[model samples]
Structures are given as structure tokens and as C-alpha cells.
Target chain A: MVVTQTNHLAGTEALLERGRDLSTPLLRAVVDRLAPPMDTVAAYHFGWIDAQGRPARSDGGKAVRPALALISAEAAGAPPQAGVPGAVAVELVHNFSLLHDDLMDGDEQRRHRDTVWKVHGPAQAILVGDALFALANEVLLELGTADAGRATRRLTVATRKLIDGQAQDMSFEGRERVTVEECLEMEGNKTGALLACACSIGAVLGGADDATADALETYGYHLGLAFQAVDDLLGIWGEPAETGKQTWSDLRQRKKSLPVCAALAAGGPASEKLAAMLAADAKDGDGEHPGAHEDFSEREFATRAALIEEAGGREWTAREARRQYATALAALDGPEGRAMPESVRAQLTELADFVVERRR
Target chain B: MVVTQTNHLAGTEALLERGRDLSTPLLRAVVDRLAPPMDTVAAYHFGWIDAQGRPARSDGGKAVRPALALISAEAAGAPPQAGVPGAVAVELVHNFSLLHDDLMDGDEQRRHRDTVWKVHGPAQAILVGDALFALANEVLLELGTADAGRATRRLTVATRKLIDGQAQDMSFEGRERVTVEECLEMEGNKTGALLACACSIGAVLGGADDATADALETYGYHLGLAFQAVDDLLGIWGEPAETGKQTWSDLRQRKKSLPVCAALAAGGPASEKLAAMLAADAKDGDGEHPGAHEDFSEREFATRAALIEEAGGREWTAREARRQYATALAALDGPEGRAMPESVRAQLTELADFVVERRR
Candidate 1:
């Protein structure tokens, strides 16, 4: 929000980089163990290499999720590396979903690069996703701790929920009306489940008691909701320079994101106008035409965004994001949360604020 | 084989039915526990229910893999039901791969029913496959046995290889030539690895020592090779009633099956002629046309099979099948196999013979 707040959140990226530095080598080794073709596709997908298999520098990710895992482990009384397996497992599962998501959504670009399916084809994408999924399980099983089985159970349950959410999200695209409650439930499954596991798994590996683990998971769950709420905001309103994509990407795609769902549920003139505009787009302006979603002009997108805001979607989403962030912070201060170190708690709180307050 | 041998192997279906009777309810329970919509797709895919979510009788596969699991566990001294979890896990994995394989290959039918992707769409198919995969791990983890992690690890490794095999299979389709060695490697990865794991995982869950597990896995591995060889034979020659698909499915699709590879590797005039026909199919026929693979006439497929047979491919594959069967039998009788009960040993021998000798 302000210069001081921005500076306070500067450590987020640093923490992420620390996590990448800790985990990437092991992740690389495990992925490289796949069959040669799969390994090549995986490396390419991870941004570790170009399509030719030459070394290439890629952001991989912000490592935000892995940081949560490691920080949760530390909060649970183990060093960050003790959470490495959990970190790797979650990261692999994330990529697995991304690979499939790219294919399913027909997304051509992600993180400023061609999507894996775009580069390697959908068949390769599917198999590579499957391999990554299997590898995630393998890595977790090899944790060699007494809690390894329980941790694995945690990951699998989370994965199922993630897939469930994606399935619902896809199904939503086909429906004329999707309730706000359904949208939130889908978001929780798609986003919250993995984030929740990202913490609880670390807690398990770090030998935390159930109460402490539950507190950390609650923190992550709410943080995930906050993150998705903010992401929905950014998808419609953020500029390309900041969000790393075209303007109004979600509106153009007619994605039933949180803000749009809220606005539609508001059921006023703005909502009616927005629905009519989208319906007309689907009727004549290439919305229903395959590959035509990207054809929306700048003026058309601006109108759509204006409709959502006028429908009260923007205000509702912003409020929900803040509410979720507060819930996350409160989760960290709950009775069982005392198990978390003060430093860890502060870092998590700042991360929650950073997620909701991010400009990109 | 005589009537006596036929009578001996008739119990194979009975064994499969018994295995199905033991594992289906538990398997259904595990699958139905997945989130809504996903549970629906999974139930339909497994033939546990109809697309409408109503209970409907459907062929739930031959249950051969589950029978292998339970029988291997029993041979290692556990009761049949003690292996139910292992059976369920392997069966889930089998269906998982089948779902993805059907999608990847774009097959419209499986087990005389519309394939999951064909009916539910590929996106749903992919997610359901993932859910099943995650469910397999969850079921295995819930076993809470000392060997649970190890068994999960075994399943993960098998899954990875199975994906590798499928990747290789897909890649081979675009190639001009595929060696028999490459074909076998793909077969081993795609088919043999999981079958091997089926036996070994059962052994593990049954508390069998590593030697016993290894012996059983070896038997299944060879049996897998033998099974694939016979399957390749049936793909070219078996009647539609026996295989439950259209005639000449593999040849029409230009699949680089084992027998075709063997024939191509023969390097005779017949091999040259067969190659020429395939090359022409690629050039002149719809081979180059996406979705044109289905345009092949029955007469054309007959000619392709005739060319493969004339090239000595059929004879070579049949001989290889018998050889692999014998090797599998030998594996069952090896010193390491001494831990297997006599009755179990005899049944396994009959199964291997039946794999190679069955007309289908």
C-alpha cells in the first residue's frame, strides 16, 4: 500500500529465492530420473531448459508455496530442509496440475513463456503431468519418517480436492449461471486445498502435534482464499505490465472468477448489462467461436470491467480479500498457534498481506 | 493343448470373478469417497455405475490384475482378503492408466462401452484419472502396515514406467520404423511393469520376504511380455467377438505392435513389402490426415495383416510368446520361487500357458 509496507514485504521474494536455492537441485535430480523424453519435457516445463534441453534460467516460481512448507516446518520445530520432501512433493503436484490446466484451458502462455502443452503438445503434456504426479508420490514415500505415510495421505487428499476444484471450474464454464457459493467452493478446492496441505504436510514431517498442524493449515487455507480473491481482482483490473499478460484476461475469457460471480449474484442493472454483453459476445463476437475469446477489443474489455465494478463486484472482492487475510492472521494468533515461533508468525502474516496487497 | 489343459485353465475366469467379488465393493467405496462429479466419472469409468449415477451392471474388466495381486499374496501365505487393499490399489492404477491411455490414443470404446473421455470429455477424463491415481495412494497409505510406504513406492515406480511406456508408444507412432527391441522395451514399461508390481506389491502386503516378492515379480514381468505378445497377435487375427472391438484395430491404426516390429526387423522382402504398404498408407491414405486412421477398409487391414504374416512376423511373435511363457514358468520354479505354495505355483503356470495359448 505504502512505501513502508512494500519494503516490509520485500523479504517475500528473498524467502522464495532461499527456498528455490534449497530445493531445486533435488527436484531436478528426481525429475531427471524419469524416462529420457519425459525428463526432457519436464525440464522444459519447469523452465529449467529450453525445448532443446540446453540449460536455461527460468523463474520456476516465486517459491511462495515451498516457503510456506519450510516455514511451517520451522514453526513446528524442525529446520526448513526437514520439509524438503514436502516442498518437492507439493511443487511437483503444482506443476502437474499446471501442465494439465494448460491443456484443458488451452492456455498458450504462462509466467511469460509458452505453456508446456504449447511447447511439447498435449499428449506429452498429459503424460508428463502423470509422471510428475507419480514422482510426487514417490518422493513423499521416500521421506523415510514415521509420519511419511500420513504426510502422503495428506498430499493425496489435497490432490484429489485440487482436481475436484478444477473439474468444477471447467464445468462452470459450460453453465449459464454459477452461484457465488459454488465459485467460492471451487476456489477453495482449487486453491485452498493444496495450500492447506503445503502447511500440514510440513507440520507432519516436522513432528508437530495435531492442534499446531491444524492452526498452520487454517492459516494457509485462509491465505489461499485471500490469494485467489486478489488474483481474481488482478485478472480483470491489473495492467499487462504488472500482471504479466493481456489486460482483462479473465473478462475476455468469460472466466467466472470470484469478482464476476459476486457481481452476477448482486443482480442489479450492472449485473444484467454485464451478462447481456457477455451473452452478445458469445452470440456474435467470437466468444463461442473456438480461439475467438482472445479477439475481444480493448474497448469491449474496458466496458466489461466497468460493468463488473458498477455491479459492485470489485468492492465485494476487495472486501472478501481483506476479510480472508484477517482470518488468516487470526488463525496464526489462535491458541494452538502459540507453537509457531514469533518470527515465523510475523513472516506468515506479512506474506498474507503481501498476497492480498500484491500489485502483480 | 488338450481338453484337460482347457479344463485346467477354465478357472482363470472363475478366479477373476472371485477377485472381482472380493475387491469391487471396497474399490467402489474408495472411489465413491472422491468429491462429487469426480466420483461420478470414476464410477462410470470403472463400470460400477451408469453415466446417470444409477447402479448399472457393467463389465469391470476381467479382474486379471487384481487376481494376480490376491493370488500372489495368498501364495506368500496371507488370506485372499488380506490382499484386498493391494488388489484395490492395483486395480485403481490399472483403470487410471486405461483412462489416460484411451484419451491419449483417442480410442472411442473400451470394454464394449464408450471410453471415459469419449463420453465425459477429455478434461474430465484427465481429472478422473488423476483422482484415481491419488486415491490409489490414499488407499495404500491407509493400510497402516509397516510395508505401506514401501508398497506405495513400488506402485509409484510402476506408474512412472507405465507412463514412460505410453510416451514411448505415442512417440513411436510418428516414427518411420520401430525396432523389436524398442517395442519390447515399451511393452515392458507400459504393460509388464505394472503387472510386475501387482505381484510384488501383493507379496509385500502379504508380508512376503524380498526374495519371494522378487520371484513373483519376475514371473509377472515375463507373463506381461507373454501377454502383450499374445495381445498383439489377437489385435491382428482375433475376431471382434473375442477382443470386443472392431476387426484389425491395431493394423488399421498403424500401431507399431510387437509382431509388426518383429516382421519389420526380419529385413526380408516381406518386411520390405510391409514397410512399403505402411509408407503408402502414410503417404496416400489418411495416415497423414488427423482422424483418418479410422478410414481404413477391412480389406486393406486384411492385406496389412497378410503382409505381416507373410513377412514371418506372426510366426516370430507366436514363438516369442511361447518362449516368454516358458521363461515365466521357469521363473515360477526358480529357487527363489520356493516360497510359493505348490498349488499357487501350479495355478500360475496354467495362467502363463493360458496367456500364450488362448485363442483370444
Candidate 2:
């Protein structure tokens, strides 16, 4: 199989825009079906309205998950429109997770605005998440396709994994340390499962064979891994202005992200230094929990970030992200495997790279 | 149109037992598939295991929701087993709501045991609820039949309404007064929707025609309303030991149940006295929030309950319960209806009576 070089950057961006254009309105319509207060919270969360129920000028987050679903459908030898419901479903599920996640983490800001929980209250946020989840299932079940049941099953399984991952993530917070392997599995469940489902559900919805679905699922799983790796990197090192977070956000939070866990597992001199810094953090009266952000001074956050980097944790994660990205691309190459059309394959490859290399 | 007065109490009990036998293991299995921590929380919530993960002698819930599904399936002309998945799905959904509702309502105990949130904390309770919900949909979608999608849709719509109802219920807490109609609508959405789905889902899975499904849904909706009316009565009037609550539970908690709302709307002497008592409650430095339970002196609680009854609120609620029960039974008597087999009809009528009249 000859893999040719192609600049799918602009094309991929256009496809993402197209996917968002197609799915956002459907998602809005589905969420609008929620009862009064939940509908208002959902619309506000989606940036369609503000807390007072007035129209708001807000551009939503990048529709990455929905883009993957739509693109995968095309790769499955079907029109992208054939996968609109899948796209809508995945996007709704993603937002559902985000809403709950923001609440659990006690996050105040998201997408440059106050989180739903911060604005409406935690109870309302929980209900909104639930409504979105139900809406996702409802949309898929109404697809009128043979794959409807199959896709619904995939989405549900992925959602279960996501919940398990969240549970593990929360459990890890109270503990002093976690193994790298455990952290990896948590990330896979939290992030990878949904992405895998996104691709597989699209193929299933597009009437693709099982083999085709499996290939995209594999691609998506690895892509999700790579995406998290890059996110971990950004959490520690990306410019605050670019990432829309505080300086050294993950370090200040003492989150058990890939790099932090990797450094703790290194068990070397630099690792000792990082551990000491973290130990001091516990006694420093920061009053910040693992799942929440900190009001750390810039110097303290920078020191922790540097200590982890010196332990080579940052480099390890960056390399792993690259490796995962390459593996994802490799999974897409074969006569039987890379059965997707060239244009769609190029688009996926570009999208995969974006996941690995995104600055924000 | 011959509706005979026959004893169906024993027969209804047998059906409930049979439904529990069929659905409990399946529900357990699905919940067990969650990760360990979540599985533990879910098991505890379902009364399968103790908070310590030890074998505890705990009688499970009545399994009324599952029983509705199974019996409805039989009424729709299918074998009970054909509705097992539907039964499991509805039970799981019901428990999911219970788990979240406990958290949102700050309920410390349920079914005479500590709530999942009380035992494991709010975050874990939330995740467990989400997992159960996903598992419910997963179980339905895995059904190797045409009705899988249809059943999933019904459950989703019902779930959405349930969430909406909860949001409304929470919002109602902040207000000084709520209309009886608003209270009834909230009950319909929160409780009626799920029971309605329980009935309609079985009918759909049993391959019932649209007419049959709609009629059964109507029956379940009215049944849910009647159930709530009785529940509200128990909240204020039942023995604490039997009801597993404090003296005058709803009054102490200041829950705007049917009687309270009716009295508030009545604008009679009882209504004025009740309002004055509640106003005194606000000034009593109780710091009453919707979800939090209150500890009131027995005398105070009894006085409040007596005032509500003297206002005729209690009688009004009791009458409404009977009216709704009659309406629910009447829903089953049309020419194209009463499609349920004789045994199932008798069983259903008994169940409806139990809802309206049960002491605990």
C-alpha cells in the first residue's frame, strides 16, 4: 500500500466546519426538546443563550468528535449525510460528558465562559447532562436504519466506559500516587472509548461492513490516546493565553495526568525532587483538591512544571503521542484495512495529526 | 364491559415476585459490569450489597416498575420472558433516577438504608447513576428484535421528561407558593413519564399495536399520579417507623406535596394558617433548603399536619387520588382497549389500588 503525501489541512478544516454546520442545529433541536429549565440550561451551555434566557453571541467549541463521526461515515463509502444522526449523537454525548465533568471537577470556566454548574448550580448541571445523554440515544434510535441498534449499543458501551474512567479518575484524586499503566487505562476509558465509538458508530450507521468499522475504531482509539497525550502536554507547557487556562494548569491542580504519573513512576533523582515539591504542596495549605484548579502563583506553577520536565516526563509523553499518532495512521493503511476512499483517508490522517499536535 | 369485583391482591403479588425473579439478576449483571468502585456504589444503591461490599441481608425494593413492564407485555399478547429486557431496562432507569434523586434531594436514606450518595459521596453517586442509565440503554439495544429501537426511544423520551420534572421540582423549592396544577404536572413528568414508559415499552416489545401501547401508557400515567398522591399522604400521615421517616416527614422538610399545594391554593382558613406556620418556619432559623431534611419536634410536626388536614388539604388529596385511580382504570375499558387479558387486567387494577391505598 502506497501512502502518498497530501495537504489535507485546509480540507480537513473545511470538513470540520461542514460537520459542525450539519450537526449543531440537530443537536440544538434535540436539546430544545428538554423541559423548560433544563432546556434553558442546555441552550446556555451550548452558547445559544445566556443565563437570563436571552440570545448570546458565542461560538461553540470545535466539533471534534462529530467531525470524526461524519468523516468516518464518508470513509465507510457512504454520504456524510447518512451519518448525521451519528454525528449528532456523538456530539451530544461529548457535551453531556463535558457538563458532568465540569461539575465533578468544580470547574468554573469552560470555552471562555462560566460552566453550566457554576452558573445554574450543580443539581441543574447534572440534569442537563442527563438530558443530553437521553437525547443522544433518542436521536440514534430514531435513525430508521438497520445499524440503529448496533450504533446505540456502541454508544452506550462507550458511555459506560467513560463513567468508569471518571470514577477511577476521582478515586485517584485522594490517593498519593497512581501507576502509569493505571493512568493510561483511565485515559483510554475516559477519552479513547468515546472516540472509538464515534468512528465505529459512523461506519455502522453508514452501512459499512464490520471490518471497516473495526479499522476506523482502531484508528480512533489510538487517535484518542494521542489526543490525550497532547492534552497532557498542553496542560503543563502550553501558553496560558493559547490554552485558555492558568499557567501550568495541571501542575497547579496536582492532577494525575500522563506526565505527572510518568514522573512519579520514574523513581530517579529528578523524580525525587518532583515528589518533594508535590509533598510540600500538600502541606502548603493550598486548599485545592486534585480535581480542581489552584490559585498558585506563577513561580510555583512554573517550578513544578519544570521539575516534571527535568524528570523527562514531558519528553516521554510527547514521544508517546507521536508514536500513537503514527500507529493510528499505520492502522489506516492496507487494501483490506484502509478500504476508505483516498479523499476521506487523507482527511482522517490530517485530523489525526491535529489531535497529536494541537496547541490548545 | 363487565368489570367484576374480584380479589386480585394475591395474583398481583405473585406477578411482582415473578418480575423480580426475572429482572433482578439481569439488572445486577449489567450493574456489575461497571468498574469496581462504581459497581460497589450501584450494588449498594440497588440493595444487593452493603456499603462495605459485604453480604448483607437486605430486602430489595418492591420492583413495581419492572412488574409493570412484564405484566404489560403479557397484556400486549406476548410471553413474559419476551419482556424481560424491557423489565430490566425500566428497573435500571428507575434506580438510576433514584440514585440521582437521592443526591439532588440530599436524601440520606432510601428503602430503609443509606443512600448511595450518603455512603459513597455525591460524585460516586452521580457516576453510578450515569452508568446504570447507559446500561439500561445497552440492555435494550442488545435485544435481538425489531422493537429494540422503539423501546429505546420510549425510555429516552420518558427519561428526558423525568429530568425536566426534577428540574421543575428543584426550582419549586425556591418559591413561596406553587399552584396545585403545577405540582400535578411536575408529578406527571417526574413519576408518570417513567411509569408510562414502563407500560408502553413492554407493549412495544410485545409487538402491541399503537393503539394498545397508547392505552397502556395512559393507564400507567394515571397510575403514577395516583401513586404520588398516596405517597404524599404517607409523607405527612404515616407512622414514622413504617414509612422509615421522621414525624410528619414532608411537613418538617416543607415539601410542597399535593396536600400542601392544595391548601396553599385553597385560600381558606387552613391555607392561611398553613402559610403562617410556614412563614414562621422560615424565620425559625432552620436554614431550610429543598434537598435537606429537617429535624422538628414531634409537637411541631403534629401541629402542622393537623393544620393541613383541618384546611381540608388532606381530604382533597385523598379524593384526587381516588379520582385518578378511577381514571386510570377507566382507561382500560374501551372497545379497542381492555385488550389486556383478564388475569393481567385484574392484576393491574389491584396494583392501581395498591398505589392509591398502600399505607407504606
Best by lDDT: 1
Task: Give the per-prediction TM-score of chain B.
Answer: 0.95, 0.93
lDDT of 2 by residue, B1-360 (tens): 123224555666787898898887788788778897888788778777888899775867777888889888888889888788999998888888988887777766677887887788777777888988999898988885678788888888889888888888877765668899999999999899999988778889999887888898998999999988988899899886677665576765667889988887788887898898777776664443543435566787888888888888899999989888898888889754565788878777878866775677
For model 2, residues A93-143, the per-residue Cα lDDT tens digits are: 889999988777776777778899889887888888988999898898877
**Tens-digit per-residue lDDT, A1-360, candidate 1:** 332675666787777777787778889989989886889999998888987779999757667788888887888889988788888899999999999987887777777778888887777888999999999988888766667777888888889889989888877765557888999899999999999888777878988887888888888888899999988998899877767656787776668898889988899899998888766765664323125566667997888889999999999999999888888889887898866789888778767767887877
Tens-digit lDDT string for candidate 1 (B46-162): 887887778988877667788888888788788888778888998899899999888877777777788998888887788889888888888998877767777888888888889
lDDT of 1 at A47: 87
* Cα deviation of B221, candidate 1, in Å: 1.1
- Worst-scoring 10-residue span by lDDT in model 2 chain B: B1-10
Q: What is the TM-score of each candidate against the true structure?
A: 0.94, 0.93
